[model samples]
Target chain A: MVEAHSKIISFASYIPENYVPIDDFAAPADMPSKLDLNRITGLEGHRRSKENEGTLELALQAATKCIERSKVDVADIDLVINCAVGSLCSELRSKLSPSLANLIAEKLGIKGAECFDVSNACSGMVTSLMIADSMIKTGQINYALIVAGEHITALVDEARTNNLWFKSKALASLTLGDGSGAYLIGKSELPNQLVFSEPFTLARFNKLCVGEASKNRPGPMMRTKAAQLQQGVMGNLGEFFIRSMKYMDLDWEAIDHVYSHPTSPRAVKKGAGIAENTVGKIKRLHNESQDIANTASTSHCMLLEKSVQLNQLKSGESVILVSFGSGVAMLAMHFYLPEGIEQWS
Target chain B: MVVVRAWKSSSEKTTNLLKTICNLTQNLLSENGISFDDIGVIIHAGVYRRNFRTEPAFATHIQGDLKLKCGPVTQESNHCFSFDVSDGSCSPYVALNVASHMLRIKPEKYCLITIGDERPNKQSNWPYQPITCVMLVALEGAGYQLTGTNFDSSAFDSSTYVEMIFDSAKSANVIGESSSAAQINSDNSKFSGDTNWLSGRHIHAFLSQFTEGTTNTHEIIDQSGKTVTATWV
Candidate 1:
């Protein structure tokens, strides 16, 4: 029987130094700026990578910080899972082999850790969390490091210069920022551990947001049915919460904080409204996308880190994390924080 | 004990990864008298994808294609979890290890693991033939039960491995097999296709020689020189 549990010991995020404002997005060559992207997406600005800062470098920074804060020796780490959707290097080259997890483990001097990559769009970090939790519970491994480094703003550049399909497809690209997040998970018998987690994919909406290599220039391109994607996710907002809450045998009142994917300010507000109607009023909801933009897989962790820095979270307080990805994948996790999480920051 | 309920394989030269995976999954479910709702989790383990596409996991596409409980999970809805686990050719064993733990913890009756890879695009270089395999695993079954598994990896800096590289002339990212990769290949078992699916083929061979009250042990080395050893009794 699986009797053990896993708790997040420490976490860290790395945002590049280059910050780009919303107004900097030029109108597509073929069309005028009819839509106020800042007003529509609720993003003031997002961070971009400086030269020589790619997914690998960003991930290394975040992972190193996470390991240092964890206070766990590097040799004791048993597994490394890289969940970066944009696995691009500083050279704008794609990395598909040897696994980024292997590279990160090599850089960290952690030998013999089982390494792999998980791809679940934006839900990747949480998905990897579930996997790590399972392994810990089943006594497979003692400690696991799950990391994501997204240098995806290259898609924004692709969206800006695109002459065709700017509004319908490339609009969501502008709401992106380059960032990375890493979490160190270890076995814990303490009550303040991951209680329950569930991840689902409403795959029917897979085509709503598609990313591929740019045809017009170098780098990547993304086309998103922003409005429709929001609709599909919102349509089931109530169900996602209810089911996850039920599995954990808890209700909205039991949760101390709610951290949602920071896709956009408007969307976060809209989702809160929908949740309020079905799942009762949330005690506290953290929305941090206005500054960092959508950091893809790292959004939830970034929010957690922010809340820790602000000293808004206390030890043993229950929290809920909500996330969605391009596969129309959704994840909900109910967990309790450990002692001194703020000091880890 | 976690056991293999059934299995399916494909080597069709089709670039449509989702379509191929959907067909195999449907057939596996129907032949086993299982409904799509009976599945609680789906894990896709593939390395090379068309166009080096990264978002929206291929496993989700399989679930969506088959319409496997494709709705928001309410109190009454049967939810299916889907994601991809990419580990070069060691994906199948890694996924199997993950499934074993999940079946012990969750109440799910079955888990599906699928693997295959195709040339990213025509402009990119591909050294192997396209191949895919899907395995249905369950906690209570009458097939090979996974008893134990182990993994060991050499130093990444010194290991000779196959990896993806950006091709400037082709203007695309393609699979780049290092010169030392061939040297490692010489020590591996020769299959018709590339080494990515060697673990899948290894397990398939183990199943072919299954015997009652007997134990089987095998090891496979991935392109990155990670060795996975599995014991079935």
Candidate 2:
């Protein structure tokens, strides 16, 4: 039997303060600021970096906040994994994750920490948790910090102007936002009450949704047509829910909360049918914080943190977090909020 | 039956260098009657030409030529002597890992291709650094088949010999030449040209430690168009 090893000690999210209405931001005629776009999408507002700030800067800010709130010593951090959809390094030739890891370590005064980046589109946070859990269980590392930061708004224009789908499905343009979310996972001697159960992927649908543009000018471009996007969502959402249910031996009613990839209102409603959630246990932040829609993998983490802050979820409650990315990659993991950690929310 | 091809050192544009190496790789694949699409996945590994800041250093260059529908790309950057010298390995791994997940295969099934061309200007970042890039491809299915293995390096001093050759060439080439040549010479002089100097010493030191007192020498030719030979003393 797979053993449960690590528990999330603390979590935090950062969004810029500015807010923009959804209609104002999504209008093709208007050029909305990042703050406005994030606000309209119902994201708490993505943390905006100075014009000169890059991926590492945004990541550092969010990570520092999580660390500070946790009051955990910097030296105690054994590993850091930065999961972002956009390029994080000034030098694409080197590992952007480790570079950011090094920067965070230096700033936090953490010595002898292993730092790297993980990219799996929307499923990045869940994947990072799996990796950290394995490492902790195997005794490779004691504490692992998973941080995801994205500025997809920067890529939205190119995606909308160049891609046919974004032009047609204008609603999606509003769904893409910017923000960062972080979680601290550490080994707990206490019995693992809530552990990462299992992870499965539907790779055949990997390319169904993605963000890419021209080769020379990199930006967010929707590769899959809108039809494929619909099909992918319909096809994989069922597969993910069914597989997760079978693996966990959970019925639809057993799931206490549904933390879904906040793609759109329609998509979320459709997803409700797949997960069999007749009750309104589904807590969504995508529409509430348009500023940070589809923060890629960080979306789930940010949403979870928000749910906690809103006092919507409680300890001992089972939460199912599902993430879907462009490659049509789908990931589902079951988790529970530990006892004391709920107070921070 | 498979053949092995190696591009040791070169003076060429980064794209050209990559094209040449990939061309050689394609030739090997074609001669074996293998189609590019049938190959499934390609892994590019190495620690050279970590200069470009925007384009994915590996996939961006090869995607057009290979006509690859969609696959992963990754590199090994930890081996760099310094930050300036090391290319990031994680970016490439992201691409490769995604491809692997899509194809539903192990890391060993994919074919890995590593190519690097360190120029004189890049020496400050340790160009010509001895880095290993590997490509793994599975023709039969997902699993990789390992037929033979060998790791010995004690017979020849690659570092000392490389330094001698580079030092002699630099001293000889320093004499009068054209304006462009002079400019190249000046640039080379700035970073202590002789790209192979530092690399040679490092390789020798590594070999000495790796082989200990044993006489290390080995060679192998594989069906996957890969040939590896090493000796250290």
Measured with DockQ on alpha carbons, how good is candidate 2?
0.05
Indicate the docking level reached by candidate 2.
Answer: incorrect
Best by lDDT: 1
Candidate 2 residue lDDT tens string, B80-162: 00001111222222223233332332222334344333332222223234332323334233222222222111111111111
TM-score of chain B of each: 0.85, 0.37
Candidate 1 residue lDDT tens string, A55-153: 888898899988998899999999999998867876666666657788888888988788989889999998888888888877778999999889988
Candidate 2 wrong stretches, greater than 4 Å? A1-4, A28-54, A88-98, A159-174, A190-224, A249-252, A277-291, B1-132, B135-233
On the 0 to 100 scale, the lDDT of residue B120 in model 2 is: 23
Itemize residue pairs with steric clashes in candidate 1: none
Query: Model 2 TM-score?
Result: 0.60
lDDT of each: 0.77, 0.46
